[model samples]
Target: METNSMEAIVLEAPGPPEALQLRELPIPVPAPGQVLIRVKAFGLNRSELHTRLGLAEGVTFPRVPGIEATGVVAAAPAGEFAPGQQVMAMMGGMGRTFDGGYAQYTCVPAGQVIPFRSDLDWAVLGAVPETLQTAYGSLTEALDVRPGQTLLIRGGTSSVGMTAAVLAKRLGITVLATTRNEAKAAALKGIGVDHVLIDDGAVAERVREIFPDGVDNALELVGVPTLPDTLRAVRKHGVVCFSGMLSNEWIVKDFYPIGYLPRGVRLAAYGGDANDLPQAVLQEFLDAVAAGEAVVPLDRTYRLDQIAQAHADMEANRAAGKLVVLP
Candidate 1:
């Protein structure tokens, strides 16, 4: 029998992982143009960690903090989707401006929903929505990476970084990723990284040692602290797309583009949402994973009560891949 309330992890205020309190809340009713999802699973993200620690801007108190969710439609008043249709929802102010996927049921704008068909485990499906969207958008929309190109990914062990490597390799692109922990180099290699550079804060010289002129493109996930060096790792006319902020330092103070950026190299950035991720692209990636042609790079799974441990693990960088929670 369906209940009128569901268990949810609510962030009452910024603090430690313990701040995420599990409680019973009323199931949200779908308004016009909104779809109510029975959230099967959700992925843990640094954005949520930041929100929990009072670092993320525009976050209100007593909010649920999941940026992405995968589930079946419980109700869709707009008739855009069937009642039992499988779908994923992400980032249309989810988790920040409003309650998100940390609950068993979440109501979101229908436009943010991407419908798909998959018998894959919810833990696996949970890891895809946001990670794939960011990686796909960064590669195609921001970098425009093509086959036969060499690409460098800063912060290689991150979920987005590892996922990007898999997608790039599938496109026949040579991937050179960086990881601070040498022990994790094999993890990168497992995902088909052509070369793994130990991130000593300056891998541009080593990148040049391999391809004298530097790489063809680079994805800066480490944020501003390493962006300058990342910029140096790319070739002239090559692009650097500033994407992830794994370092939690995004801004470059007193910016001067002339001196800050390389002369011929172009600088781009990617922070896309559901609109940027086409339904076809998402479906194709899911199908590839299901067929064993791709991987989800999932590190661990947790229940709603284990959210605190999950956040602690993520904060300590204990996981080598994406952390997901089955609500």
Candidate 2:
């Protein structure tokens, strides 16, 4: 391969995991206000999965797909970071609008590439971007989890769910994490969560048995199908942050009808937007992980060539935590 070119996973036409073709493409040259990233590692997010399956609209063909990444600055117009300085970025129309992080090199808007300072490895840091951002937003922005409060993680095994559980526990919050997989319950408890509940359809019933008043906050990672149970698990006036749609159902019909909502319960939602995450906040979160104050568990690592297998494991429910791809 030419020195100016780099390896990348390109989506010629959205289809199955096999459509993510590994090819040698010319490395991107940063335009003014943008920096060329020597992507060391990138994460596989559900948004990319949806795009690769042709589920996302407005996606032109022959595009590289990846929403979040962690790496060093290869080239940049004189700015806040020197070449080789580490950085990370998520959303910001990364994979959806143009070429993103599924490559050895990516050109990102300078404003979007957050200077992430941490001594963690690329694979470890790569696990932090999207998962940490979403988890932090849901905990601090939406749920406002406080010390001594009780929290519920509906999709306990999902990346967001697990991250939220760990952050809440660190804040002295009692977390009641739920998972449909009974075998995973012990793993949840080992993560410092106060309790782990089997996520059967009777989640509300089980929760009520443990805490009669219900949990103080709930992070509903699942979608419409589990929202009702999640609502019932929260105490009156408590908050429920409706985040990911693990069930693949985006909207709930008649969700606004008062009867379906828990009395005095508040609803909040989390969506990925580059601007929504301030640089200082992102830095602080990464600092905590670097200091061992919070945990962002990484499940699997794949080479750029094994991109298809990574997506396959994610879709098969085999990954117990975040999946990172080393480019």
Candidate 3:
């Protein structure tokens, strides 16, 4: 545990889970307008998995591959934040153009950091940053969801889907969540879903069976494979926010908006960073989580040394919720 050097899971080149190797690297020093974060914990994302498999574009190796982190501010060269202030950082070229949260330290632009205070454990806190920002942004910015609206989460068991369910319920929206696994249905129910639809590729008819006029909105987390059916599951003027890509099939070849979208069923996509998560919203969510009014869908936690196994479990779809690593 030297002050200058820290442990990190470095991706030497795109390959398997074993490619994420633990190594000692110099703690990054922040320049003006940048903040140095003493990474406590970081969350595993499919984005990182895609990078490891060389599916992601613009990735450079030997790199650290974590997109989101939660920790305390070790230094803010621009004085944007006080030392020891708790914060979360994500995106802004993290784990992509430069070293990211896969290390014990990561330096990111100040604009990419959102400040918050909570007594929640680092593991729980780590899971909230990117996941919550994406979920909350998709709900508010992409879908414009409101109270009394009915939401259909196409990938309910995924972390973002589950988090969206919680946020939707808290907003007084009626929730209908879908899961491919019958065993995971109860997990969705535990989060206050009004109905749990078993997804067998097409859940539109089944959605109509419940809502009749179709749901007021839908959150498509399974990517383009389910986008069409999800579009059909929404009512006229209802929106579908394309968010997560649990299936890792994001691109839709020969996409024709006219034929692709159901008339009046508008489709929107959300790919947000930390800046999209307003400070107030982040603080409120953290407060809710700390008060037990909300929950972080954290499935399991691992140490820095277990990054390979963690990535393997993530790739294998073994976790029902977010997988986090403590560095």
Candidate 4:
């Protein structure tokens, strides 16, 4: 078969959203242990925006910037994937280290791709994996959240936050989510979240009202500024799983309740390491989605060319659920 060029959104330079340019680039060939996918749909993550703005370290310029995608295999090496098989892939630094899904075709490791159930929609499958996996990893693997426990998700309306809320609710745990937007509180409650608190100066007080003594676990997606509050919201011996920093990365300077440290409270960091743990998390999320226990609510969909608008929306904190890009 003759090779041909394909359209891709490339970050020619690391600067702003305008640096991302759509260009006709040569289609990549799958090497050993890798498969080339004809991407049907892809999803945006905050890390991709960080990479584009040169905030993420070690990212190469002229790179593609999508981490999660659902597509059909177009080519694979011997003993690997078969052509025309629908699959889902997320994490593994897809858009960071290698060419990623924001293109007509993406070459990724076969091990990173898993076959999706035949009944699943490509757009939903595309939006599900990444944030779901991260949420699963943080909750089950890191925090070990259990039934009867109260869990607080800092960014409750965020993609990962909502996924965590759903997973925790399925596990019979009470979920308390914090969002800056009061408008999403109703939606969060409708989705089975036990409580939704608008992120504000009174957040700690409101959380204390819901949990009384304190929550059993906290999923801190927003870093630094919220870390002190997260520590305060957890019961003694409770666990806090620090994940993403949607706000800022600076350390909190406020004095915290260090006297409570004798109670055996633990702070653990999760995600960003996309190796063995991520693979396990991915499998668990896929199983949950396949079982109908999990759902990825897509807030919006954009064509590949509208990536700039997607980033703008995300940066503006205007989206409530996962943002998808259709190829």
Q: Of the candidates numbered 2 and 4, which has the greater TM-score value?
A: 2
* Candidate 3 off by > 4 Å: none
Which candidate has the top score in TM-score?
1
lDDT of 3 by residue, 213-255 (tens): 9999999999989999999999999999999898999999999
All models: lDDT? 0.93, 0.84, 0.92, 0.80
lDDT of 2 by residue, 17-71 (tens): 8989999998888877888889988988888888987888678888999987789
Clashes of 2: 0
Give model 2 RMSD, 1 decimal: 1.7
TM-score of 1: 0.98
* Model 2 quality (TM-score): 0.95
How do all models score by TM-score? 0.98, 0.95, 0.98, 0.91
Judged by TM-score relative to the true structure, which candidate is superior, 2 or 3?
3
Task: Give the lDDT of residue 317 in candidate 4.
Answer: 87
Total backbone collisions, model 4: 0
- Candidate 1 accuracy as lDDT: 0.93
**For residues 1-327, what per-residue lDDT tens digits would candidate 1 score against the true structure?**
867999999999999999999999999989879999999999998899889989999998889888889999999998989999999999988999999999899999999999999989999999999999999999999999999999999988999999999999999999999999999899999999999999999899999999999899999998999999999989999999999998888899999999998888889999989998899999999999999999988999999999999999999888878999998
